[model samples]
Target: MPTTIRYSISDLATYFESTTYDRIMVLCDENTRTHCLPLLTKWIPHFQIIEIASGETHKNWETCMQIWEALVANHFTRNSLLINVGGGVITDMGGFAASVYKRGIKCIQIPTSLLAMVDASIGAKTGIDFQDIKNTLGTFYEAELTIIDPIFLQTLDKRQIISGFAEMLKHGLIADKAYFHQLLDYSFENTIDWPLLIQQSLHIKSSIVAQDPTEKGLRKTLNFGHTIGHAIESYYLEKENALLHGEAILYGMIAALFLSSKKFNYTSAFISALENFTEKHLSTAKIKIDITQVMKYIQQDKKNKGDQFLFVLLDAENQILYDIPCSQNEIIEALNYLHD
Candidate 1:
């Protein structure tokens, strides 16, 4: 049976009330601690709170070790509840710690960022990046529930909002054509209908995640742009000072769309539509990425088996996942197209 889910601001309280657990642990970062934590404290006042430094760089085994130490010190058992209340980094690391601590425990995700609500929170795939590789160590563990409130987005900066919008665009490209069109029509600047967008994007992601929780078959489709997207993300993380996940994924989507047109023979019209939509919302910042570094990261991707790199290319109308063997030259071309 599928797990229960809710997407409302008040649902967190309701969920907290209904659950029977000895103790609850709420995880937050510095930013979320300053911004969203106060708002959440009114409802979850009695719970044990754990604050960690925020950012993708902190999502690692070292942080996980610290969480484990905290759990041990606080006498957190298997029956204890962990509520992840922040962006993807917090949710991902927190979920991972909960899953591994005492051989897995129940967790609730109260995602604050746009990216976390639509993509990271629903999937239950939790992990931290190994060195520069993205999501290197992780597990498939479903959350007991996920509570989403678009109200938290008001505190987010414009770049953060745009970053989250990239994943919503990915959700549309993979599943709903109408939703994709709707996203194109909406303005990212001032006219975003957060509630509707959150519902639609979560619906698309949850349905996909429910169907293939382990990411063994159709769920691989959810990684439509992630193969190159993740590599691009790692490359930027290693080379640059600060690049948000959504921003890298936005560029990844651009590259994937270009690859779809050139290699997969997708229509120019479709490519044009994707380009126009991305250009309107995504920034065209020139990140000087070394093709060799990106290739090394791609080769080390967990999805790759043996020597063959499994690349997910979009078909006409984005109907099916076509797994293709891509070469270094092809990847360079894709990145080059993104630069151009």
Candidate 2:
């Protein structure tokens, strides 16, 4: 069965009334613990808290060990409940931990950041980074429930919010052209409609995941920008000035657009519009291309089959094409486009 998703905080409280657990633990980062937990505690006041340091840098085995130790120390049984409350890192790692502990435990996801609400928490994909590779260790574990409350979005800064917005843009690009255009009109500076946009984005993702839960076919389209994007992300993972996942994806999408133009004649008008949109909404920050290092990461990507390079590209009609092979020169040219 698909995971149950609740839109309001009140729904979460109401849910607890009908559910029972031997022990309950809320896993969050320091940031979420400070900003988002108070709201949750008001409704579900009896759970123990396990707080970890925030950021992608900490989403690894060490952190999982911390959570597992906490669970063990707290005597968390298989019947216990682990509620994950934070952005992508928390939901991903929390779900993985819960799924692995004592075989499996019931877990709930309460995504606090915009990225998590729209993409990470909605999908049943759970993981932790291993040896600096993104989502290297993971399980296809579904949460009991995923609670999405837009109120937590208030706690994020513009950068973090924009980071999450990148995934929303990808959702539109892959599935709904109407939504793609609708999101093009969105501006961070102006008043926004969070609930409607969130709902739409979540719907696109959920519908796609429902069709291809294990990514055998249609779901690969959802990775349109992620192949190159993840490579760029991994390349910067060790740097002092690391790139956020969404920021790297924006670059990846631009590169993918270039590839699409080569493969399927994507119009100049659309390309120009995308450029204008990025100019308006994104930062002027540029990442110098290190093609050698990036190619290494790309080769390591999970989507690759044997030694061939495969990507999810867009067609002239803005439709997605998965497992499209591109030559080394083409891939380098796409990355080079970002440099210019």
Candidate 3:
């Protein structure tokens, strides 16, 4: 079953109170432990805290072991509850850790970032990076409940908000052209109706996840920007100032849009609009890395089948086309297009 998603604190409180568990633990990172956890404490006051280092670099086996050790040290059982509170890293790693501990355990997702609220925390997909690959190891472990409260968004800075908005834009690009354009029209400088935008993005993603929970087919469309995006993300993961998932994805989306325009008969005007909007709002042109190294990472992407590189590109009507095979030259060209 699709996990229950609640936008109301009262709903989360009611569910939390009704559920019986042997123990309760809230898994969070340093950033969230400082900024986001206190908000959750009002509704869920009694729980052990498992704190880990923040960032994509820390989302790996070593951290997973740390989580497992904490669970073991705390005597967590299959009946225990783990509440994941933070951004994508926390939700993804926490869900993976809880899913594996004692085979499986109950989990509650309280996504505290715009990205987590709209994407990571909604889907049952849980994963951690392995050997520099993004989400190379994980599971489809559904949380018992997912609470998306926009209040936590206040803690995010402009860059973080922009990072989260990249996923929102991808939601529109993959599923609804109208939504894509609607998002383009909005100015981030002014006030945003985050509730409406968050709802629309979640609806686009959750609807896709509902049909293909295991990414059998339709769900792959959700990875529209991620094919090349993940490569860029992995390339930056080892750097001193690594790119945020959405930041790299913004570049990925730009590359994907370029590829889509070439493969499909998108009007020049439409492509122009996409370019202008991207440059204005989400461009990562200032960030430079070795395109060749990124290519190496792309070759090692988890989504690839054998030597063939699979992608989720768009057709002329803005429809999803998954498992489309693209050659190394074509992929290189697409990555080069980002530089142009």
Candidate 4:
């Protein structure tokens, strides 16, 4: 069965009251500790805290060791529940640690960031970066539940919110045409109904994730912009506050849309709207990684089979097509198109 996703404090309180869990803990980062932690303290005042360094760079084995060591010191058992609070890094790392700690345990996701609430926190995948690739080490353990309260988004900065919007754009492009149109017209500068939009995005992704929990077929569509997006993320990860995952993805969406137009005869109006949006909001830092470097990372993408690069491309009508083999030269041309 699919895990229940709720958007209320009462639901969270009910879970905390459950006798199924013998112990409870929160895995968070420095930023989440300062900004988002207090929101949970009222409900989970006695819950153990597992704080770790923030950022995609720290989503590694070393950090996993920190979580594992903390649980050990606290004598956490299989009946213990770990609620992952914060964005992608904390949920990914926390889920991984909880799933593998003695084979398996219970995990609940409390997604504070827009990206996590809408996308990352919904999927059952748990992984940490290994070698130079993204999400290279992980498992298929699903979370027991995910709590997404829009109130936590108030703690996020504008950049983080915009970064999260990128995935929403991808969600629209891949699933709902009306939603794609809605996103095209949606403005990030002003306030809107976040709870509504969050539900919309989560439904699209969750439906896909449920069908292909193992990512064998339909689930691969969720990786729409990630093929190149993840490579760009890897290339620039070392830089200070460098491209957050969604920024690189917005850049990749630019390239993917370009390829979609060229290869699939995608409508000019839709493509142009996306292009104009990119021109207005995104900057060249979005693709500061040299073409060669991005390509090198793409070659290492886990989705690629053997020597060929497999891309999930969209049709002119915005329908998704997976595992389409893309050539290096064609990819370079797409980069040139994105640059232009």
Candidate 5:
């Protein structure tokens, strides 16, 4: 399952002009509708536009129903093409909707946000959060193509850019340490060269995904920071001042690093380097976990089996140790360590 990640819009324009579908429809959130869709409209003028509310909060069945209803009303057939033109939430929910609609439909991803462009849009893992759980219902439906235009990043605020940068950092940590060093060169103040950064992140992820598409083994490393990150993201969903996915992920990575040192005996210098780097880049929030409540979410995590919690831990060599069944007590201990 090698995902074709288009780097240049000129190349994408060439492809879009030559390609044709029965019915072309595009799904975008308010933000992307304002900022990014215009670029697509230039090349694809006749595509039907379906606008949805933005944010991770709207990623649910109700919104998905709206998408399905729209597709139904439009008389979309299997040959119809669905283009997702927003960040992670839009692509995730839209891909899920497009996949199940009429059993399946051809879909393409035009990832505007850095998060979507890098990780979410590449994997073809379509999902929507259910009952506050992250990505509860989903399918592995690959997009016919994925177009990544770094031009969209021009409108992004520092926080939005930083949000995506977390995943890139994770990619480096999980696979290539040298890539991690490359990431340290930029920040919210010092801008990044998006084309190169996006390509680097894509290569790391695609190479890993190429080995294991259905997450049977190696793909689990991608879930490194997510196990705890999703819990934090879910817990804060109802709050007014919620952290973005990457912000939450930074915390999860910190906790995971702590756990890695305790569980896998990861090198002390590497753990310290990661902690210092993360703390420097991400703002810390005083999220006082109920510890008990969060464990419930972890227990219900998709990676877990009956009464067992699965973690992807980093070992001394900086390689991932996936499918490590960790004890609840150990997790609690890690949580306590984080709290301290």
Candidate 6:
């Protein structure tokens, strides 16, 4: 049976106290090594540390090969534990490496970013993006445990925080109506109640993954704003520098909202609320979108089926997410709304 784990900052020591392993390897990026590892090392004394170059560009086969070589050279056997200690990129690649290494090994996730804690950490999906395509190469491997510590948010830049929050907002829009309304009441300036938000988002993802771990059915709901969001992210990432994951999703959410209103006849009031929430919280970074480039990227999206592009749009109350298909022209119109 699979074990369900709950992670909290205060419970870090207690969580690791009972764990038994011959050797432990901690994977971290530059930023995390400088800011997070010092604090983490005090608790986990009997562990070897490895640092990889930071950023999305480094997530590739070459990197994976390097990790594999290190494990082999160091004689890291199956009895060893791989502890992924960073954001999405670290967790995704680390989890993938551990899963493939030695056929399989126990891995744990200690996510630092809000995005990782709520979304990436919970899901078994792990992979590296190929070329410009997002998450093109990957696997479904759940970690033995996931440890979430909001205290690490102190080291994150404002942009990183906002990026993670977009996914959290996506959780609310897709499944929980009450959580959606509650988000409307909180501002980014205020400290988020981490425990409550983490539990709610975990519950949302856990329910979906429990029903469909392979993503054949209801797990599609979690892709609410990801369709167009990922395209925009890829397009801008290729054309420009400095666009964060959450920022790209912010624009993706805007395009999705427009699609929801147009196709679903979702009420104008609901639309206004979503737009207001976006403008107030999301930054205005103008991205030059060549309609052709965006269209090309969308064609390669993993969610695309046949000729139509599928999107997860919400109803008026924000309770149910309807999977709707849009033609090429409709997608262009939705992109225009981002410019407006």
Cα lDDT computed for each candidate against the true fold = 0.80, 0.88, 0.85, 0.84, 0.84, 0.80
Cα TM-score per model: 0.94, 0.97, 0.95, 0.95, 0.95, 0.93
Model 5 lDDT, full chain set: 0.84
For residue 26, give model 5's deviation from the true position in Å: 0.9
Model 1: per-residue lDDT, tens digit, 149-212? Answer: 8879989988888788878888888888789888877765566778888889988887887788
lDDT, model 6, position 327: 87
Query: Best candidate per lDDT, number?
Result: 2
Per-residue CA lDDT of candidate 2, range 1-340, in tens?
Answer: 6789988888887888899999999999999999999988888748899999999999999999999999999999988999999999999999999989999899999999999999999779999999889999999999999888899988898878888888988998888878988988876788899999999999999999999999999999888889899999998988988988888888888788889999889766766666666666665534686888998899889989987889998888877899899988889888888774
lDDT for position 327 in model 4: 87
Which candidate should be chosen as best, given TM-score against the real structure? 2
For residues 1-114, write the lDDT of model 6, one tens digit per residue: 233465654465776788778888999999999988887886674888788998877878888888888888789999888889999989999989998999888898888888
Pick by lDDT: 1 or 2, better one: 2
Candidate 5 lDDT over residue span 1-340, tens digit each: 5556677666657776778778989999999999988776777747898999999999999999999999989999987988899999998998899889989888878888899888999877999998888899999989878888899899887788888988998998898888887786565576568888888899999888888999999999999888888887787787788879987887787778878888878877766665666667664433567788778888889999788888989887777898888898988887775553
Of candidates 4 and 3, the better by lDDT: 3
Which structure is stronger by TM-score: 4 or 6? 4
Better structure of 1 and 3 per lDDT? 3
Shift in Å, residue 284, candidate 2: 2.3
lDDT of 3 by residue, 93-121 (tens): 99999899999998999898888999999
Lowest summed lDDT window (length 10), candidate 6: 1-10
lDDT tens per residue, model 4, 1-340: 5678889755877876765667788999999999888877887636889889998989999999999999989889988888899999998889999989988888988889999888888778889999867999998778888889999988798788878888998898888978878877877777779999988999899889878888998898888888888887888886675789888898787788777777898767766776676666665423455789888889888899998888888887667999888889988888766553
Compare candidates 2 and 5 on TM-score and give the better one.
2
> Candidate 3 at 235: error in angstroms?
0.7
Regions of model 4 farther than 4 Å from truth: 284-286
Better of 2 and 3 by lDDT: 2
By summed lDDT, the worst window of 10 consecutive residues in model 4 runs over: 280-289
